[model samples]
Target: MGRGQLVRQRVLVPLFGDVRGRVISWSSAGACGFKGTRRGTPFAAQTAAGNAIRTVVDQGMQQAEVMIKGPGLGRDAALRAIRRSGILLSFIRDWKCVESRADSKRLYYGRFILAPLMKGQADTIGIAMRRALLGEIEGTCITRAKSEKIPHEYSTIIGIQESVHEILMNLKEIVLRSNLYGTRNVSICIKGPGHVTAQDIILPPSVEIVDNTQHIANLTEPINLCIELQIERNRGYRIKTPNNFQDGSYPIDAVFMPVRNANHSIHSYVNGNEKQEILFLEIWTNGSLTPKEALHDASRNLID
Candidate 1:
């Protein structure tokens, strides 16, 4: 064998097991210069964990299983740093070393008191909590228009659509999908006037009127109708197909207006130049049914 081959064979390799064909990297507070009382601090632990993961990645490591030992302040901090590093973690298991049951109890009790006082110099925990509160929890709202009829003076269907859109904008929760082409998840019913029937009113895609009872009215009187919309909290627009309407029926062309919440206002650039609040005030209808027909049929079912 050549001299180079002999040297390579003699080199010592750290044994961290096959670990499911993954590279193993580890660190402790002591390694990051936390001495004495500071060794158990969360700050030292986070720094040490970050350095260890970086070293492993430099060695071409892509994923890992983390086995954390000891009940130290850095336990959670180190884990958070590892997650933020973008390395895929298979699993995390505790390998805590306990001297006795009494010692374990004391450590556990101490943690509850020391947790708030640790004052770690990191924002990971704060960011995590914020994401959980804002992104995890969802809210919903439903608005019903009781026997509201489109005025006969409405010259075009666009005028009626615009009025409905304005009413939706006054809501606090967002309308999921509204566009110039068509509205989704919005139901309308019209009845009690002219030749319009329940079937004549074209609903938005994925939207339907649950109640179908008609209220009698003469041709001279305005049609009695109801309009109900379901709204939800979302960071961006979400498209949904409501379970109520699924018989291949779809809404006429309409626009969705923005909710009138100051705190939830979203700003976007207009015409690629001016920055403006992304808000819509009116909805326009463009489908098979005319505005009068929609109002007539909608009056059939009154949403309680």
Candidate 2:
């Protein structure tokens, strides 16, 4: 017999097939009468796998090979259930597929699981961590830009495709990292008939750009574009104010949140006499910091 298991974030499906690759039986946690969030639990997956294996066992199936895919809590539980079904297992394979991209940087994403907490504690921790990650984590961003030729934000240069205001907006999207604190100055001096990206910016040794391919502006003709930028590391958002601009420089609203998104889910399970809960947390970042680092700093901030 051949078996396949598809484990998703909220569901588990097990399939049984004959020697010729014909599907003999299939079952899912939802089909096993598990409702709502309970359907995603490992216990529900265990029940589903047991039920499916029983049907195939009665049909004269003996040895089986299993293939499991995706990330979910049900993966290991389903495998255990299949093992306990009295069927000899030939092999078990875990499969994962990663897409290829032109960019050299890998996606910054992380998942964490915390378990065996008392009831109601998971939600409290989740809320606190989410707030800390989104509001308290420090990041580097361009807070001001200066150009001698461009007097104001609305001014436009001859060869540049974007206006001064638009260029500042694009600069705001650039993700940067720096080891040192306080404000620093950087400059971009590009002579175009070409595209200008984050890579063209001249930064200090302590600062680095996260994504070099991030587009800043396009120049249709050969013209010198010289601009100075002021970078700062801080937490949360900073609104533009009159005091930000000086000389020929224009102020840009800065965003210092390194974490792009964060969320959590709670799963409950029995722990002897008392019921316990598990916290599943996921974090996505802007490449300036890893999710693990963000989580650690957030937890530290909470402790402080």
- What are the models' TM-scores? 0.26, 0.64
The alpha-carbon lDDT assigned to residue 293 of candidate 2 equals 71
lDDT of 2 by residue, 1-304 (tens): 5333221122256776654345677677767888776876899889888887888788777777664434467878887887888777776544222221222352577777655455775687678779988998899999989988797788888889999888999999989988758899899999989999999999999999998999999999999999999999999998998766678888889999888889888999898888877777788888888777777567545433
Best by TM-score: 2
Per the 3 Å backbone cut-off, how many clashing residue pairs does candidate 2 have? 0
Clash pairs, model 2 backbone: none
Candidate 1 lDDT over 1-304, as tens digits, reads: 1000000000011112132223344444555566666755677767776776676666665665554433434567776876787766665533212211112210111110001101220132223322332333222223222223433212223323334334333332222322222222344455434533233334555433222222212233344445443322223224333432323322222222121111111223445553322311111112212222222112111100
CA RMSD per model (angstroms): 22.8, 16.2
